[model samples]
Each structure stands twice: as C-alpha cells, then as structure tokens.
Target chain A: MKFLKIIFLISITFSLYAGEYAVVVNKKNKIDKISKKQLKNIFLKKRHFIDNQKIVAINVSANMPLRMKFEKSILQMSREKLNSFWTKQHFHGISPPLTQSSTNSVKLFVKNVDGAMGYLPKNLIDDSIKVIYEF
Target chain B: MSFKLKTILLVLSVSLIPYAVIMILMGSTLKKEYTENTLQEMQTQLQLNVDRIEQYLKTLNRDMHFMSRMDVMNDIYSKDLDKRISYLLMEKKKDLEIEGDFYLFDKNYKIIASSNKNILSDSKKINKFIDVEIISGFDNTKIGNLILDFSLKNFTKFFSNTKSRNYYIIVDKQKTLFLEKKFSNALKVQMPLKNKTNIEIVLQEDKEVFQNILKEYEAWFYTTLFVGALLISLIALYFSNRLIKPIISLSKAANIITNKKDYSYQVDVNSNDEIGKLSHSFNTMITSMSNVLDELKAESENKIKLLQEQSKNEMLEELSSNLSKYLSPQLYASIFSGEQSATLSSKRKKLTVFFSDIVDFTDTTDTMESEDLSELLNDYLNDMTQVALKHGATVDKYIGDSIMLFFGDPESKGVKEDAISCVIMALEMQEHMNILHKRWINKGFTKPFKVRMGIHTGYCTVGNFGSENRMEYTIIGSTVNLASRIESSAIPGEIFISEETQILIRDSFETKEELKITPKGFKRDISLFSVKNENKKTNKIILNEKGLSIVYEPDLQDATTKKDLKKTLEEFITKLSV
Candidate 1:
C-alpha cells in the first residue's frame, strides 16, 4: 500500500513538473517577448486579434494533468473556475480554443502557423521556437 | 368468504379511502412547498448575480464616457488631421492607464496609429477589434474615435472578493477575459442549469458552480425525503390511534355481541367526537336488548311454572275420583287413602253388600254419543250415590250403570235392616234418572240404564284393598262375592240374595224358599233369596229351582227395581196366551 501511495505521489509530482509552461510564438515573428500582463490578456481570450491577424490559441488533453497545470499556471486560475467563465461565453458564441497534445507538436504547429499561441514547458523549448511569455 | 375477514376488509376499505386522500394532499402540499422555496431561492440568487454583472457594465459605460470627454483626443484632432491621429493614439494610451492597448479610427473604420512597436499588425490592430456599439459612441458626428483594451491580467484578482465565485468578461468584439482554467474535452458544452438556460457570457465562472450544485441537489433531495417520511409517519400514527381507535372498538364490540350471542358488552368512549357518540349509542342499544332478553326469560319461566302447577292440581283430582265402569286394580290406592277412618279394621264381622248392572247395556250402546252417554251415566250414578248416601250406605263403583253398594262399610250397625233401605234407594234412583235420560233422547242418543241388586249378610273385610299404593274401599269375603254373583244372575230391576241375608232378616221380613247357586267362589250351591220391602210383613215364600228346595224372604223382592220379575212372569203368561 505504501509503495502504491509512493507511485501515486510520484505520478502526481511528474504531472505537476511536466506542466511548467511558457507562451510561445513563431521563431520569425517580429514581436519580442511580451509582459505577463499582455500574455494573460491574449491567453484568456481578451484579445482575439493582435498585429492585424486573428490570434488562434491551442489546447492540450484534459486528463493529462500537465495540460491542466499549464492551463492553471498561464491562465492563473483553477480549471473549474475557468469553465464557468467560458460557459457564459457559449451563449455569445465565443469558444475557448482549438487544442492539441505534446509541447513539441504545439511548437511545430505554432512555427508554421501565423498569430498562433500556446504553452509548453521550458525543457521543450528549441532553437526554432520563440518564447513569448512564461508563467 | 367468511364473516370476520369480510368485516376486516370492509374496515380496511373505509380506512384506506380517507387515508389515500390524506396522503395525496400531504404529498402535493409537500411538493409544492419545497419547489416554491427552492425556486424562489434560486431566482433571488440569479437576480443578485445579474445585478452584480450590470454594475460592472455601468462602470464600463461611465469610464468610456469619461474618456470620450478627455482633452487629449481633442488636442490630436486640432493638430494636422492626418498627423493628429498618431499623436492622439499615443497620448490616449498615456491618459487611459486603466486600459493596456489603444487605437484611433477615422470615419472610414481604418486604423490610423499604432501604440506597440513591432510588425504587430498585418493590418490595423485596434479599430477592427472594436464593436459597433463602442464605435457608435465615437461615431455620433465626432472628429474621430478612440478604443482601449482593458488589462485582463488582474481579472482573477477582481473576482477574489466573491464567495467561491469565478467570473469572466467578454466584450462585444469577441475579447474574452477569464479568471480561471477551463476544461477542453466536454463533448458538449453543458453549462450547469440556471432557469433552464446556460450561464452564458461567463463560461469559466459558471463551470465552477456545478460541482457544488450537484452536491447541494443530492443533499436537498435526501433531507427533504427524510423530513417528508417523518411527517407522514407522525400523521399516520396520530390519526390511526386517535380517530380510528374508538370506531374500531365499537365495531369489534358489535361483532362480538352479534356472533357470540353475548349481550354483556359495553364501550367506553371518552372522545367528544362522532365515534364517541356511536359508542354511546351502541351501549344504549345493547342495554335495551339485555333488558328485553331478561324479561323474556322471566316470563318464559313463569309460564312453565304455572303450567306445572295446573298439571299437578289436575293429577290430584284424577287420583281421588272413582272409576264407575270396572275395577281397574291399578290406581285405586290413591283414592282409597282419602276415605274416612271408621271404614276399616282387620277383624271381619257381619255386613250387607249389594251389586247391580245396566241390564243388557252391552247390546244397547252399539251406537251412542260417547260423551253424552258418559255424561248420562255419570248423572245417573251421581243421583244413585246421592240416594245411597241418604240411606246410610256406601255406593261402590259401577259397571256401566250396574252399581254395587254396601251398608256397614265405613259404618255398619248391629242387625239393623240395611238391605231393605238399599232396595228403596235403588227404586228412587230409577225415578230421578228420567230427567237426564229425556235430554239424551232429544240429542238423538238412544241408551237405557237398568239396575240389578243383590244383598247378603256375612263376616267380611270392609276397608281399602290391594296395597298402600293401590286399594279399594270395599268389603270382601265369600259371602260378599256371592252377593255380586247373584246380582249378575238377576234380571234387570230385580234383587237377589243369599240364604244368609234371609236368616239375618228372617224375623222381620217375609221370605221365599232359596235357590242354590254353585256360582264362582262358593264351596257348594248356597241358598239365595230375594228381598223386596223395607218392612217384612208376609213370610209365605219358598224357592224351587230344578228340585232344590230353600226358603226365601218375601222382603227380598223389591217393589220397583223388581220389575224384571214381573216382566218375566208376563212373558210366561204371554207365551201361554200365544
């Protein structure tokens, strides 16, 4: 039982560690690293358009706690508390985001796409990626 | 099928109808109360939340109006019209420190200036993002318009004051502000319920409420159910024991009385209700029934006792009355016990006995009124006894109208002329009986009575006979029986006697020669003669029967009851004449 508890704790810790997230843009994008205030506004969908282009956001798998942690960290709130906000948006026809899994996949997709933003851990950052904000 | 089960079923049916009605009313009231309370609470909460959101909207409107009146945008519009838009945008960003981004648009809806330094916009950034409602604020015939984007980073901090509450703001331009993380993989966007509508315009804030609501819903369900069950139990207990109890008791008592035939039941009803009244009435009815039954029982007992007493009296009367027909040896003692004490002793002495029969009565009564004939016979016997009592002799029982009387039975004197007096009584009885006999003739009854008598003197027993249980008040000896045989042998209306009687009265009466009769109970043929008159005057008579010679007294032949001898002589004379 103790071993099982240890395994459970380890998995939770790994999940927590895995969700260390930063907002990234394309490597060739002209806008430099933004402040946390601007990043929060973009990620929370306060601004759907930036730099004359529609700002599209990406998401990750729900059961992956890493993805949940990324959402909580970057959005700076609990998932349940966040859903209540979006549920209100459903009447106004404002959806949250198009989502994907794995930091590498999000990075590759963001590189090819314009005005795309998403979160990945710093460990997943590579030379082809541009870090826009961190939480 | 049976009475008791049917009775119980009837009670259950009546009880259930009202119980069902009460239960339905209880359930409906409970449902209505709970629903009204919950819906009112939810509606109040929703209104409060709506007021909170509208307050923020008013604030935004006020802030926007304040910015519209600012001198900074006016300074830019007064400068070179094309050059002033950029300067107005830069200055407006400084003045509106509450909003992070700023933009300026001319009448054509084109972005005129940029605040951020980058290749940030493929086109103009801010003007395209503003809603028509905001644009109209600047559009009402003004020089130009300014739009500002408020900072969303501090949104979570703004909502922290609410209790377990989260919120998001979205502009009409599709700028979304969320203060919480969101679930992405719900196949459908099923917002928690509020008045059957999704909690729109604040998606993330509404999702946080559903978990608590689900718990609250479950708790309210269980709690209300528990309370409802308890209330129903209390209701059932109260009415079943209180209201139904007395009625049930009354019903049971009634059933017990009806089935067991026990009217000894009572009910105690303390309630001042209908059931109590019913109990009181039931008790009254039972009391009445008990009284009636008691009276019936008493009357029945009285009738039985009275009948018993009447039968007892009848039996006593029958016991003492004599049978006038024949000597039924049975049932004679009860009558003989009532006789006077002077009638009996063990030592036998001389006594005179008489016997008689209805002459040819056996042939005469072939068809007759049985009751009339019996009444006629009783009357005749009554007159004969009255005459015998007058003559100081006891009238024995009769065979038909054939009566046997005796003197000195019960009371006899020494050598007194008792046989001659018995002859005179017999003559008077025949004379008196003509009155009753004429009545019999009018009633179409034809029967006649004639008597024959015999007398003798001998030593005999004169008392009751047989035993203490059964006896006859009679004289019995060989001489007495000989007198009875002589009477049987005589013609109707004649008297016969033994030689013994003639010797007893030989000095005072006239006698004829006696004929010997070897009849029943005689050792040899004894000489028997007849007696006629009360005073013996003549003595020149003798009996000659088949060459046996004996003396007879002339006083043995009666003047009236001796008509049979005259008839026989007349028949003889007639035979000679014919």
Candidate 2:
C-alpha cells in the first residue's frame, strides 16, 4: 500500500515536467548539470569547448518530430530565425551542430563521445547517458 | 468374312459407334463441367480463407497498437521497469494467441524489455517486425519503439482445418513468412491485410483433383464403349441366325436335289415369312419337275410298246404273204379278210367242177429226161393255172400233170355262165398248152406235155375238206368223181364235159353227135358229146361199129374232095388185101 502511494507521488511530480525535454550527455563528462542558456550557446556553436575539453553537441535530423520538439522547447527560436542564424554562422566558418536521423542515434552519439550532449523525450532517458539539463 | 460374320460386325458397329460417340461426348462434357465447378468451388473456399487470415492479421495489429500505448513506457527512469514491461507483453501474447516474441526498445536504441527473455541473437533480430510504432506519454513525448515479432501461424492457422489438397501462404515484402506446404501448381488468391501489418495472406488449391477426375472419365468412357459393343454384337448374331436359317436350308435342299437327281425331296417350311414362301415355291418347282418327268417316262414307255407291236405286225405280214403263195387266191382272200375260217367242214353248192390230166404223161415222162420233164410239166401247169385264174376258176389241186378245179362254190355266176367260163377256161388252157409245146420243142424237149380237161355242173361239197391243222379247200362227192371220170374218158388233147356241163354250155359251144357211155359211178348209160365248132358247114358222116353211113350234098364236094375220095378207096382196098 505504501508503494502504491509512492507511485502516486511520482506520477504527480512528473506532470510538472510535461511537455519538457531533457538534454543528455555521456556519463563520462565532468559537468553534472548545465544551464539551458549555455547548452543552447554550445548547440549554436557560440562556445566550442567546455571544461577544457572540446564539446560535441548532437541534433536530430531536420523535420524529425523529436528534433522539432527539441528545437521548440530548448532553442526557444522559430524555424525561420534559426535558419538565418545557422546561415550566418555557416559563413563565419562555424557549423551549427551535427545532426542524427533518429533519437536512438542521438543517444548513441552522446553515450560514445565525451563532452557530447543531446535531447530526447524525457520518458526515454536511460543509464547510458546523463541529463545535464531539462526543457 | 462370311456373310453372317460380316452382318454381325456391321450390326455391332452400326449400333455401337453412335453410342460410343454419345458416351464420350457426355463424359467429356461432364468432366469439363465438374472441373469448372470444382475450380470455382476451390476458388471460393480460398477466398474465404484469405478473408479470415486478413481479419486475423488485423486483429493482431490492433492488439499490438493497444499494447504500445500502455503506461509502463513512461517509467523508464525506474529500476526493474524493463522486467515489468516484459511480463506485461507475455500476458498479452497468451491472450491474443500470438506465436512470437515482443520487444520494447528505449530511445537509446537498446532493447529495454522483451517477452523472449534472451539475449538478442542475430537470427532473432532479423525477425519480422509488425506494428513498429513509437511508445509515447500523455504529453506526446517520444518514447522507444514497440516491436512485435509477428507470428504467421496465426494467419496460416486459418487454413489448418482445410483439405490436404489445399495450402495457405503468408508473405511480406522480402520473403515468404509462413506456408502450410510447398506447391508447384495451384490456384492462388492473395489478400493484403489492413494498414499496420505489412503481410499478405494467400490461398492455393492442389491440381491433383482435376487429374483424378480426368482419369475416372477415361475409364468410364472405355468401359461403357466395350460393353455396348459386346451387346450389339450378340444381338446381331442372334438376328442373323434367325434370318439365315431358312436360306441355309434351301441351299442344302437344292444341293440334295442336284446330287441325288431326285426331285421329290421337299424343304421344310417353318415360318410364313418371305423365306418360307421361297421354300414353298422351291418345293412347288420340284413337284412340277417330278410330274413332268413321270409323264415323260410313261409316254416313252408307250412309244416303245407301240414300236414293238408295229415291228411284230410287219413280221406277221411278211410270214402271211409267204404262206399265201401255197393257197388259192379265193381261199387266201377269204381267210385273210376274215370271211372264212379254216375248219374240217364242207357245204353243198352248185359248182362247175373241172379236172384235167396230161395225155400219156407217164409214157412221155419215161422218154424225156427228168429235168426236162419236170420243167415241161411246171410250164404246162403254170400256164393252165394262169388261164384258169383269169376265168375266175378256183384251182383246187394238181394230180401229177392233171389239174382239178372248181368254180361257182367260193365265187361263181349262174350255173350256165359257170359252165361256159369253165369250158372257155379249158379252151384257153389248150391254147396255152400249144404255146408250151412250141416252147418245149425250142428247148430241145423230145416229148412235151399234153393236158386234157373236163367240166361238170353238179351239186357238190366244196369247202376246206381236211383236218383243222391240215386243210384243203376243194370240191368232193359224185359230181367231183364224175368230173374226174369225164376227164379220163375224154380223148387225148380233147375237152370233155359231162351232160350237165354240156347242157349248160350248149349255147356258147357246138357239140358232136351225142353217144351213150356208162361211167363207173353211174347206173345207166349217159349221153356224152365232143364239143366242136357250131359254125362249120354240115356234112353228116356216121360210122357204126358194123357199117358206115354218109349224108353229104353233092354240091358241097369239090373236085379235090373227089380225088381225095378216090385215093382213099385204093389205099383202103390194098390194106384190106394185107
């Protein structure tokens, strides 16, 4: 009966995180947590390194539903505004981010590379990667 | 082929050919219909199976979709949560009659939970995935993929209760997932399931059913044909026997007649049909031939008998003509003409009986040679007999050189005519004897025959006067004897007749002066006369036994007569002196 109450409390708390996404990184990374602004700056290639290591930020493929969700909840920018920003950054000899076709590939990239970070549905988090931020 | 066998074959073929054709046509048509109907039936059955399998696949996809939306996927952060998901999938698998495993993959590309509870093998990882959908929360946050290792048995099991002659197949895009069995030839129908499942259900029918039907039809067709032909043959043979029996018998009967040459044999008529009528006609012809043969035989026998009789009659005529030579013509005519019969009998009638003998024929015969005498005698008698026959005298018999004959008994005129014909016949015979004498002298006969004949008219018995076997047609009694006496008493070369004959012949003949003599058969002297010519001039001179008497007219004696009388007186006186 107490276990049932504990499950009920967990369900209540998870409602607060509804429509939110978690930014994950490999467990080997030294950063235990990260601010959404810094993560967005890293995904936009404004900061290329973190904790004296090179940072590799992963994005899902263009038009992927998860990628659209991640862009809306984390990047906080319209598609047209991001398209101009990436185009400006592409001229400055900086690529925006590396993209994967599915959330599974984004998770695999984060788990295998150090200092790498990606986002997925919050219910899809597993032990192979750490959530550095949530959106 | 013999006639009967050919006829039988003809009948069998005539009846059976059409029957076999019809049977074959019907059998083939029925087999075609059966094949079409069976194919249609199998197609409908395969469609029903395809529909059921499609529906079953749809139901499995629905189950899989419902299971994917369960609340356990949102507990990915909890410990032992993967084990809980696997247990829940196992429960669904039992309820849904599913035959394969289920797997739940997290967003990190790891199988977080699976119903198989084993490490992912390579072969198992290549399993057919059905209803691969995202597991999501109420916030539409993307979870991992829910994968069902879809079982084709659930699809193929729909046809498990079907016949052995059918198969069911399940196929996806790349490979055939499940099939009941392999099939080379089949009638296949495919049905794709509704949306989420990428599988097709196929139904197929084996070809052995149609092949079996064709074999059965062929066997039935040949069997029916054989039986029908046999029946027709037997029936034809029976009828041919019925038809040919009479003809065979007729030929046999004809052969018998030809070989034996007997037309009396008849064929049996057993029916009133045309063959029977033919037998009747044949029998009738035989009977007619037999009748004609019998008639011909009888006619030929009669002809032979007539021929024999005719030949026998010719022989009898030849014998009778020969015997008639020894008989008198009157007697021969009378007997042969059936007027007289030869018997020992006599009848009295007025007959002119004549008898004649040669004058001193014995003395003449003794002087002449026997051959000459016989020749002279035959000539004299043949001539006399001919003369007598001309005068219608019945010549009776010849006594040496004498002839005894009679007229007026077998045939005659009145008594006076009879006497005259007898005397005339005697005169003619004398003339004929003179001719014979002249012929004999020329033949160097020294002495010739002299015949004298006498005639008498009296009532004498003149008939066949001998035994029945040896008969002589002659005249008998005193009249015959007197005729003989008169013939003997007459002078040589003179014709003498009795007074009865003289009285009858007096008018036709002249008589000498009547003298009186007594014959041995008479009791008194009978007057006899020497017949002479009546037309001579009369100089009556009579010489009696003692004296001479003369009465002559002196005018009648001429000078030659006076001289002859003087010379005769001198010679007479001189002979008287001697």
Highest lDDT scorer:
2
Q: Which whole-number lDDT from 0 to 100 does residue B363 have in model 2?
A: 84
* lDDT tens readout by residue for model 2, B109-218: 56767777783744445465574565543335566777778666655566654453655455555567556566676656556655534466565666565566568877
TM-score of chain B of each: 0.41, 0.58
Badly placed stretches (over 4 Å) of model 2 are A1-135, B1-251, B269-285, B342-349, B383-393, B408-427, B462-465, B472-475, B491-495, B498-518, B524-578
lDDT of 1 by residue, B420-478 (tens): 45545555655555765686677666565566667776678766566666656666788
Screening candidate 2 with a backbone cut-off below 3 angstroms (N, C-alpha, C), the clashing residue pairs are none
Native contacts present in each candidate (fraction): 0.00, 0.00
lDDT of candidate 1 over A94-124, digit per residue (tens): 6666555455557765675556677777888
Candidate 2 displacement at residue B231 in angstroms: 5.0
lDDT of 1 at B569: 64
Alpha-carbon deviation at B496 in model 2, angstroms: 3.9
